[model samples]
Target chain A: MSATVHIADVVKHYGKVEAVKGASFDLAEGEMVALIGHNGAGKTTLMKMMLGLIRPSRGTIAVLGENPAAGEFSARRRLGYLPENVAFDAALTGRETQAFYSRLKREPVKDALALLDVVGLGHAVKRRVDTYSKGMRQRLGLAQALIGRPRVLLLDEPTTGLDPELRQTFYDVIQKLAAEGTTVLLSSHALTELEERAGRVIIMNRGLKVADGTLDELRRIARLPTRIRIKVADLPPSGSPAWLPTATPYRRINGHIVEIDAAPDEKLDLLRRATADGSAVQDLELIPPSLDELYAHFLRQAERPQ
Target chain B: MNALITIAAKEIQQAIRNRWVLAATLLLAGLALSLTFLGSAPTGTVGARALDVVIVSLSSLTIFLIPLIALLISHDAIVGDMERGTMLLLLSYPVARWQVLLGKFLGHLAVLAFATCLGYGAAAVALLITGSSFDGEGFAAFAAMIGSSVLLGAVFVAIGYLVSAVVRDRGTAAGLCIGLWLMLVLIYDMALLGLLVLDQGRNISGGVLSALLLLNPADAYRLFNLTGFANVSLFSGMAGLAASSTLSVQALLTALVLWTLVPLACATLAFSRREL
Candidate 1:
């Protein structure tokens, strides 16, 4: 599949301060990419460049095969953006706001209004935006961004104000869109939330993309030890398990449970040995490096002098 | 073009929903009607036509009130949107930056035109209902006053847009707009008068005086409405200045239009280059 969005050597400078310093990435069609970073890590800046809200000081960005910053960029109709802390006109009703955005996107008003219900805002469609709660406004923002069924959707902190159920519904809608070949790039601080949703993750730190890969790929690169917890059936009151590998260290939680940090290559061997007879181990659980840990690991790797 | 209209329509819808249209219309109508009754009272003694007197009074009112009203509505158009984070989303659409600027300009101008026409039209209608007698010349002058008042409001709206585009926040835009209104409407003419007195006709000639008058949009609007018609100029006691002045009606109107276009262009340029 071709890249729906492309960036190469993108450098954005705000005076002497560089916001995005020489970053390069491409998002393929139907890819759900999470842009995870701390605040001021240039995630929003990169998204704005794709939206053509600001021109990069150097390098080029293409969205839908057109330069987004070009004056006559025709691909804008097929691009949707939800800004951080998304805002709408307080004086307008939710329906009016949706219709306004629909008109701008040259989409049918009926379809756009229907998205309000899809985002679970049907009950408050007629209420003024000022009266709506933060979550409702976020739903309205999401509905607005969904107009025109944009092929490329860029959302910054989209799930900030959403409840758990709404977040589930939000991910369901996004996953459906991605399934239909919509390229999704979202930036958020919620790593755990994105861990299960995003198909791939790009980690940024200090205006640089430090890591980009699937969870397993990043895990392979970082080589952080996997954690394994084993509940033994019959453990001596004072002695450790004889089957425990001597190369890897183990921590005792209590009489029956012990947690061990297994290197990636040794995890399967240890698990097999512990469950070899099916009599010594009552339960076993393996936990890999989470996105949060990977995020910190990558940031630290980027920060270290190499 | 469709995007332009969409943005403009949104602005108009917002103004209506916020009661800006109703409030501006009522304020202008209330003041225009009161001025019509009170200012025309002396017309009976002076033997001046009531409509001509009303035109003069309304022209002066426009010089002060219209700019303030225009600024009040427009000073926050760009900066407020940027601060609220709406402009960032709006610009993400297919619409060009100039389209947003011009679209909002047209929308605010429409709002001002509606208020000016209906508010001042009520006064004219009231005079007719009261059986005030006036010739075709008086009617023409009344129409010109209303037209120029809207034009004058457009000038300030464009100025406010320029301020909005250049300022960092709404508070600074508001402060700058008020300062501009005072400088143009009140302080500009006073300072000019002082300069003329100091010069005592030695350095300033008739040509120079005309240029000076055209420098301020309020003065240009005042000159166009008050002195464009002989009947209104005579009643307002500007006939001598009208005769001596080299500025023509077309020149004054052009000055007002240029006042609007230049700042609007500058605002568009400023806004297009502004980083959201």
Candidate 2:
């Protein structure tokens, strides 16, 4: 597939402050790529640069082979953006707002109600935006973005106020859009939320890109230690057989709990030895690290001195 | 072109829904009606005739109402969007910045046009009912005056958009627009009068006076329309100067066009560079 978004050493600054420092990435077509970063990590700033709202201080960013800051309407015509906090004119009702955007895009107004229905806002279609709850407004925003069935969709903090069910619905819609060959770029601090939905993830910290890859690829690169917690009825003395040599073992979060991290091969050996010793291994668990841990670990590494 | 019209339609929808705007429009219309009724009453004096009264009220309103409405309508066009975070959504579309500015100006002009015609039309009907001298020329003069008022309002609509684009907040946009109105309509005219008086004894017929008139849209509009009002020959001297030296169909058209162009150009430029 062709690359839909290409950023080569893009840097953006606000006065003396560098908002996005030497950022670079490429997103292939039909990909749902999540951008994970903390607040003030330049995630929104980078998104603005991609949308051509702000010119980069240096370097190049091409969204569908066109520079955003060049005021290239051809590229924007195929693009859809959902801002972090969606706001519409309070004077207009939901349908009016949707129809306004539809008209701006030169699209038929018939699909607006359908989009609103998909976002579960069909019942309140005639209510003014000021009367909408935060989540409802976000749904309307999503509907607006989906108006023309754009080629590339940019969603910022899309799931902030959504409940689990609505969040699942949002992911389903995104997956459907991706299935139709649209490139999806999602930026949010919800790493766990994205971990399950995104085909790939790009991590940013301190105005710089820290890592980018699939979930497994990021796991391989970070090489972060896995953590397992077990519950025991009794305590073993420190530095005894209770602590496996091949693994790094630690004491309980609770008095009866023990936690350990071991290599793949040694993991079974450690569990076998614990049972073989006739010690009460009432419960055991083998846990892999999650994307949040990986993200935090990489962000720390990025902040560390070379 | 369709996109520009779409934007204008949306702006009109928004302005119509503004309660403050509706209230202000109703109040102004009421004032126009009441002034005509009072002016048609038996004056019992020489200078208090119906035509004189109608001209006084209409001209005074022209000095204040047109610019005030234009500023109120457009002073928040851009800055309000920025504050509400809606500008990002609009800019993300495939529209140009100038298209947005022009669309907004047209929208505000539509509102001003509707309000002006309604107010002045009511005044005309009230004068006719009171058995005032409602001749064809009188009606023609009133139309010309209202035409000038609308064009003048359009100039300030552009100016208000520029102020909106420059400021980051609604309050500041409003403050700047009103300040600009005060300077151009009130203080700038006064200062020009002071200068003309200071040069009263000298032979000072030059481009300096024409350039000064161009500096104030309100003054330029007054010169354009105030020439026909009797007893207003005090201003007719400056009007004559502008008409003889720099005023023509082409020059007046150019002046009106520049009134739309200059502020709109600044607004679009500012909007292009704004982070939103």
Candidate 3:
């Protein structure tokens, strides 16, 4: 598969401050990728550069195999975008906003109505945008981007301020689009939200791409330690000798419970040996390295000295 | 072409539905009607010529109402969107920046032209109902009045968009647009009068006057509409005093074109760089 988005040593600067410091990455066609980073980490800048809204200070960026700054309408025709803060003309009703965008994109008028239905704005179509709540307006924005059958969708914090149900609806729509061979590149400050939805993640910090891979791949790269909590009905004395030699850094939470971080391979063996002693074991809970922890680890590395 | 029409249609819908725009347009129309009636005072045959008086009132009133409407219509073209965060949505479509600018310009011009025609037409109908004699010259003058007002309105709309593009906030854009209008439409005329008074009999002929007229879009508009009428010599003499010859029609047209170009170009450049 061809790379839909290719950024080669892209450097973007705002005068004295560098928003992106020679960042480079690529996304293959039909992939759902997430860009997670802290505020001012150049995620917005990079996304804008891809959409031809901003020019890079240095380096090359190819979105759908074209230099974005050319402002080529052909390239834009193939892409759809939902900005972080989606706003509409207050005077226009939801139907009107959708219709205007559809007309501008040269799409079928019915597409606008269909998108409104999909985004759950069909009932509110006649209401002016000024009366729309934040979530309603966002849905309208999504409806517009869905017009013209675009091939690539660039969404910036697509679910900001959305309730949990609506957010899930957004993810379902994204998944449906991606399954239909549409490439999606989404950026959001909400890591957990993206973690559950994105097929792959790109972690950025200080305008640099620190990690980019599947969840398993990133977890291995970041080496974020695993956490497991064990609860025992009766406390084991120091002389009980139930613990394995590998559980060296294990700490007792209380008289009965203990918490420890161990390698994935060693975790089961450690647990088996601990329970083998049968010193009144109660229950155990294992927490793997989630995308949130991986994100924090990369962000911290980008901030600290290696 | 469809893109342009699409944008224009949206702009018209937006302007019509906006309470503030509707209010401003109505207010200007009301003022236009009031000014028309103000010129109905009974005077000598020359002054009592209601058509001439109406023409003068219109010429003067448009100096204020044209800019007021222009400012109201266009001072929010880009800045308002940026502030409200709607600009990004507009930009995300496959529409080009130039299309947005041109479509907005045409939309505003259409609305203003319609409003002006309504006001001017109402005044004309009122004059006819009042038994005012309709002379050929008076009719021609009235047409020129409407034409010049539309041109002047278009020029100021471009200026307002330019100011809106450069300023980030709506309030600042409004203030700056209004300030520039006052300086050009109000203060520039006064300043020209002061200059003429100071340089009386100094061979400040029409060339200088024409050059100054070219420099000020407001003055260019005044000269264009008010020339060949009752006080033609007052303006032509001013042109003569400031320069060797009277202002050329060609030169005036060029100046007006430049008036539309400079502000529009600035607006385009500013908008292209803006972080919408």
- List the global CA lDDT of all models: 0.92, 0.81, 0.81
Per-residue lDDT of candidate 3, residues A216-293 (tens digit): 889878776678788877665653335657436777776667777877777777788778867656888888898778
Model 2: lDDT of residue A92: 93
| TM-score of chain A, every prediction, order shown | 0.97, 0.88, 0.91
Model 3 off-target regions past 4 Å? A229-241, A251-257, A271-284, B43-48, B230-245
Q: Name the runs in model 1 displaced over 4 angstroms.
A: none
Candidate closest to the true structure, highest lDDT: 1
User: Which residue pairs in candidate 1 collide?
Assistant: none
After superposition, the stretches of candidate 2 with alpha carbons farther than 4 Å from their true spots are A230-239, A252-257, A263-283, B42-53, B229-253
lDDT tens digits, residue span A150-227, model 1: 899999999986889889988999999999999999999889999998999999898999999998899999999999
Candidate 3 i-RMS: 1.3
- True lDDT of residue A66, candidate 3: 88
Residue A134, candidate 1: how far off, in angstroms? 0.5
Q: Give all TM-scores, in the order shown.
A: 0.98, 0.90, 0.92
True contacts kept of each: 0.92, 0.83, 0.79
Error of 1 at A273 (Å): 2.7
* Model with the higher DockQ, candidate 1 or 3: 1
**Span of ten consecutive residues with least summed lDDT in model 3 chain A:** A238-247
